[model samples]
Target: MSAPVVKGWCPGAHRPMMSGDGLVVRVRPRMARLTAEQVLGLCDAAQRHGNGRLDLTNRANLQLRGVSEQTHRQLLDDLANLDLLDPEPGLESRRNILVQPFYEHGDQTCRLTEILLDRLADLPELPAKFGFAIDTGSNRVLSENSADIRLETGMSGGLILRADGSQTGVCVSEERAIDAALGMARWFARHSSPELRRMRNLVRHTSLPGHWTGKPPGPLATRSEPGFTPKGPLVGAAFGQILALALDDLIRKSGARALRITPWRQILLEGGHSTPAPGFVTRPDDPLLTADACSGAPICPQAQAETQMIARQMAGRIGGSLHVSGCTKGCARQTAASVTLVGRNGRFDLVKRGRAGDEPAMRGLTPEDLLTLTDLT
Candidate 1:
């Protein structure tokens, strides 16, 4: 059978997407922190009903792969029992809020996140992928992330509600932040057609409020590193894929107080405690960190080539960032990479300094042929 195609919206726990795998069910943990029991429960559920592995998404969500249609109902029930499922099916798509993972309890980010969650119902119905970034950290941490709405710290250290792709933002008090955010959403909803789903798209055609102006926030302060940092212990998952059994074991051994997922192919273990786990990237310069890969071939029927295997082989040898995509869809990394290898008909097409969909510099190169090219240096 061919792989099922997914368009427009993202997959959720209640609404799954079909892939080469039987079914892909996503889990969005409220606040990005999962208890040890919840973590273990998720692993057990994935192993029992789906593929034994879990995919950590760029949105900090978890995806269970290879779930059979027959077992999907049971799996949803299991997830609900674990307090992992959204109460209302509609709420699942609307609760696309991402909180900074390093936030402390009762911090501004946490407070704002709660407010946003509570106000989700008041907002106009948005596209499933439309999201908010509650990035009120000490420094902007999610500037590079995907979000239509952003709650960021302004120059005055006061909160600002900024629409993505807009340099300006409206200053708002902590109390009114959610209201302003919702107002912006309503504005966008009123003006947007189906094609204009995101704030960036709406801004192209419609004018924003005059009040939405302030100094733009800076870029991400620093990229998170593996192992223990003051914020937490960062553990890397090669190609952003982790086996449920292995992760369960790691959690058992690490003794972390809590766990938070990151978009950067790593997991942050809160509390000062963490033990090095096998198959995890511990060092900063681990070559795998520079490579973005997707599950290809047998796992994804759309894939004509194996992606992770090729990425693993190219890790230490290749310099700079690389993306090994199963096809032109470029699911692994949305942005253009320094070098991209797009698979076609069991061979690779090289796209230099562009995304997978970009015109290829060369085509039909096997992994061995690709490695032998002197131009790679």
Candidate 2:
């Protein structure tokens, strides 16, 4: 059966509305991978066809917000030309798959990931947030906080696919390794309600399949540290536009085509290493990494200031992750970072929370004064 057509708020659509069932519209520009030319094209397209702004999602994906209905078709067509669209719409959001930067470089893990995408694309009910991680046996992969399903190399030339906190399947071949993951995803889709959008959610309520014995698998030699850094030095992009352009260029220049869009609004470009050109920022200590801002004010109709601009100004100055929202909607990151700046009128309010959704202390402050609030710093 063909996948279900997603209903509700289509992202990048011109309409300012909300939909419980959101649609993930895929775009492909020549630079999905990072190359200089591709990066420029992506930036130009985003500026012209989108809200003249771009957002960097925690998953490291570049989202062009405020896309009008007229441009939506063009965006999809363009992305398709770049081979960015998943064959099946059902798999669009569920394609939350990741691979270790090291293992992804011309290895079996990368090949297996493609197969997994193909398999999940055919499965209609996978949750919109269903995710997979294939470790390239590198230290710089995302933590378990980032993936619902993970594949790590095991001792004796086998692979182990873990679900939530337990090992569910083990295989000797990469093909079988990915197949084991798809089996679990399809099972979750069959048993879960549409409201349970993530694998963790499903795991919270349901027991494992009968085939799942809950037995611990054999010890694997290649275990990834929870938050191991990837092979290269960490780089941060001020916003999604910079990231999109940098990624496009990275893909073009370096044969290192595998890209991992992280949830931290950071892009992980694997393979060849290159420095950012003039007018672009790539340092970890850059202010952009320290701050996150939403599309605010004039652009969002729901914002108070151009949060991105404010954030860019305060990036490196702030010590922890400071999220700047145009309004309470908070489209920046899912989990609250160290500090949050919610904009209202020309002023801002400060909130402190350990995680995304925690109640914050809504005290007001000005941008200039915010620089002095040293608790987070």
Candidate 3:
């Protein structure tokens, strides 16, 4: 099998990435919240045009995998009908904004996100992967997520435009937050070349403003399990994956007004309270919740070995978070895993307390052997 392809850019509904099974069409919902009707339509489209699999990305985007070329146009039309598609591809590509999920309607988070989306056309062309995180909630939940420019809560309970790598940021109010963020984007565009696309990369070459001493925002609230939040109940999808049928069933049964897609593999339902959903991880201690696994083997042309199945089987045996990657690319989890098993020509290479691309402690072990060895270790 050929090595897994890592496109520096992300795939969208208009521009999809080719995978082993078929095309992967990604949908970035407005504010990462989908209405109940929109959710049902998305599931229907996935069931009809794709492989009946919907993968939730770390960026809180939903992807319909295994989409056939014949059905691609129809799926796009369906998405458009659901008000999910962007008429212009350029605007769509540039509208990579992630918002905190717990915001109420007409709140600061929603207002700022709407402003950013409207002004996406005004910004200079950026790398497809470059994005903005609007984490201006009671606490910051997206610091751990990927975002070049952040509009987060300042230590003094105000707004700040903080670069990803820098501790200091320029303080701004709600009215001027977007302008400050856009200013940062323009600055990055002027200073950056193709090689330096992200804010972190630009920070290596240029220094950001240190005039404002507002510290980074607060910690993320623990919401990765099936439980009740102020907004509603959250349901966890194992390995950040949900079957189209199961999701459709859950939406129908839950009677939720909307579904808030979170980066942590959890989906918040807008309702009075939380309820346990079948075929979902409802507990915090579920091993699958901690394990990160990519779609491997026949599903991905780059994979030489199976991954998700092995990750599920090995989840209980491993002590901490485990990443069973299809290859050295480590697409599943960017962070270092407690135990990483990298796939190579149908065999596994183990990297203890390191990332998938890190130096391996052992090589060329079968899946069974790998599990037994990890058990002993």
For candidate 1, the lDDT comes to: 0.86
lDDT by residue (62-138, candidate 2, tens digit) is: 56655565666676665555455655554465566665444434576667766776666565555444567776452
C-alpha lDDT of residue 302 in model 1 = 78
> Any runs in candidate 2 off by more than 4 Å, and if so which?
1-44, 51-54, 65-67, 86-94, 154-158, 165-173, 209-234, 243-276, 301-306, 313-317, 327-329, 344-347, 372-377
The CA-based lDDT of model 3 is what? 0.86
List the candidate numbers ranked by lDDT, top first.
3, 1, 2
Q: Candidate 1: misplaced stretches above 4 Å?
A: 1-6
Output the number of the lDDT-best candidate. Answer: 3
Residue-level lDDT of model 3, residues 109-155, one tens digit each, is 99999999989988987888999999988778888898999998887
Residue 377 in candidate 1, Cα distance off native in Å: 7.1
Kindly list the per-residue Cα lDDT of model 1 for residues 1-377, writing each as its tens digit: 24435479888988898888789999999998888889999999999999888999999989999999999999999999999998799988888888888888999999989978887789887788889999998788888888998999876777888989898787889988888888888888888898888898888788788788665664556888787877667889988899999888888887866779987888987763667688788888998998999898877777779999889888777778889998888989989888899888889999988998899999899999987886762
Clash count, predicted structure 1: 0
lDDT of 3 at 375: 48
Better of 1 and 2 by TM-score: 1
**Candidate 2, which ten residues in sequence have the lowest lDDT sum?**
13-22
